[model samples]
Target: MSTESVQGGGNDPAIEVTPEAAEEALSLLEGEELDTDEAGLRLFVQQGGCAGLSYGMRFDTEPEPDDLVVEHHGLRVFVDPASRNYIGGSKLDYESGLQAAGFHVENPNVVSECGCGESFRT
Candidate 1:
């Protein structure tokens, strides 16, 4: 229900962070005693999944020089150039339910995902 648009560092891909995700990420960052102004969630794609690519997320003290920086709802997200190719136009959301509760990336670039729903192929 919360709509928050991201401002990208360049004309590259843009990611939308839902209000829920922003709140949760900011809370986590604060819990870790990180600098909210500089620290951010690093989203990246790595090889190895059955579908050929898997998404990864972690907290970084700061973004790399070439990383794509985006800010939304007081939360900062950093994406490397290589990972941007697979996650552009994506929506980062947080889902809380009895079955699963976590940050999920609804990626538009995915053509198919593995049965487990952990990996995807473009």
Candidate 2:
């Protein structure tokens, strides 16, 4: 696992997750009965989507050498080095509503977001 600090004035360039987010994810895992013993989450950015960049998340048990690992509330979250620039200072949260529910990323680097909220331009 690797970690680096984003450089800027008056900005903390680190990914953060709220307690609600952690609990929500945990609840989802429990509902799915997914094996979380060695399971972890991975977040990355990919090209495509209306805004040129899209977010990706997955569950993993291993991390690559260049992955940036973040831990919160006993949960391990991994991010690829290349995607770090786009997700700097972002927050991960879980949301549930009558219409939709899932993990959401609040990114400071996002300049614009698509109507579907599946992608962003920065």
Cα lDDT tens digits, model 1, 61-97, are: 9989888888888888999989988998899999999
Which regions of candidate 1 fall more than 4 Å away from where they truly are?
1-9
Candidate 1 residue pairs in backbone clash: none
Error of 2 at 37 (Å): 5.8
Q: Candidate 2: where are CA atoms >4 Å away? A: 1-12, 28-37
lDDT of 2 by residue, 28-107 (tens): 65676766555567878999998799999877765676677666775666777778889978999888899988889999
**Top model number, lDDT:** 1
The weakest ten consecutive residues by lDDT in model 2 span: 1-10
lDDT of 2 at 65: 69
What 10-residue stretch in candidate 1 is worst by lDDT? 1-10
Estimated TM-score for each candidate: 0.92, 0.79
Candidate 2 residue 73 C-alpha distance from true site, Å: 0.9
CA lDDT, every prediction? 0.89, 0.75
